[model samples]
Target: MDGLRLENEIEGEKTILMLKERRPIRHIVNIPKTRNTFCKGTKCRKHTPHKVTQYKAGKASLFAQGKRRYDRKQSGYGGQTKPVFHKKAKTTKKIVLRLECTVCKYKMQLPLKRCKHFELGGDKKTKGAALVF
Candidate 1:
């Protein structure tokens, strides 16, 4: 009942009641620096320790087919070739973790839930600890 809201309405001797609960959205998410998971590498197909890091996309290649086509289409005297995307619906991007197997050096990607803020190798949270100002 801490974050609950109740409403009652009466119409023609009929009573209607409604209850709603509100929860705050979490902002920050902390992840560990390393993880022990199953490695799918040919050399190491067993559970092993892996170094964890946030996955980042590399720079786009200019020689790619899409980039080459786009560049060629824009080379002419055209104001705008394609419609620019403006209707972005998502507020947060899914976080991807890059895990590398320690023994075989095999890398794999693991996607996580979307969060407003992501922290890598952050401090652990202790229960019942007083909040520091």
Candidate 2:
């Protein structure tokens, strides 16, 4: 089949337009909406019902050793004391799941592969459903 084309007449000149070919779009990652995996807590050694949540880094403490040292170094009259990080290569961050044992109230972190988007307890996708870009 022929691709898309357009014909236009402006003033006294005839113009023809051709649309550029589009590249195939990549699909987003799909994960189960809910999971009931094994719990490795001291109270519950067997598989039990656990709450799933995304893992996020906590705020850095001002009283930390590295932060205190960096702040001390920057307080002087000298110019920039330490080198700032600017070389970031990866586009997506690794997904981490924070699993908490409902029985023993124990929490653990589970690291997964890198993904652009992450959803916890989201809607379940069916096979026949069309995907939205």
Give lDDT tens digits, candidate 1, residues 1-133. 4444555556646554455655444589999999999999999999999999999889999999999999999897967898999999978888999999999999999998888999999999999999998
Candidate 2 lDDT, 2-101, residue by residue in tens: 5579899999899999887654332365555345778778778888777778888899999999999999999969989989899998677778888888
What TM-score fits each model?
A: 0.79, 0.72
- Model 2: how far is 81 from its true place, Å? 0.6
Best by lDDT: 1
CA error at residue 43 for candidate 2, angstroms: 1.2
Q: Which regions of candidate 2 deviate over 4 angstroms?
A: 1-27, 30-34, 130-133
Each model's C-alpha lDDT? 0.89, 0.77
User: In model 1, which runs have C-alpha deviations exceeding 4 angstroms?
Assistant: 1-26
Alpha-carbon shift of residue 124 in model 2 (angstroms): 0.9
TM-score: model 1 vs. ground truth: 0.79
List pairs with backbone clashes in candidate 1: none
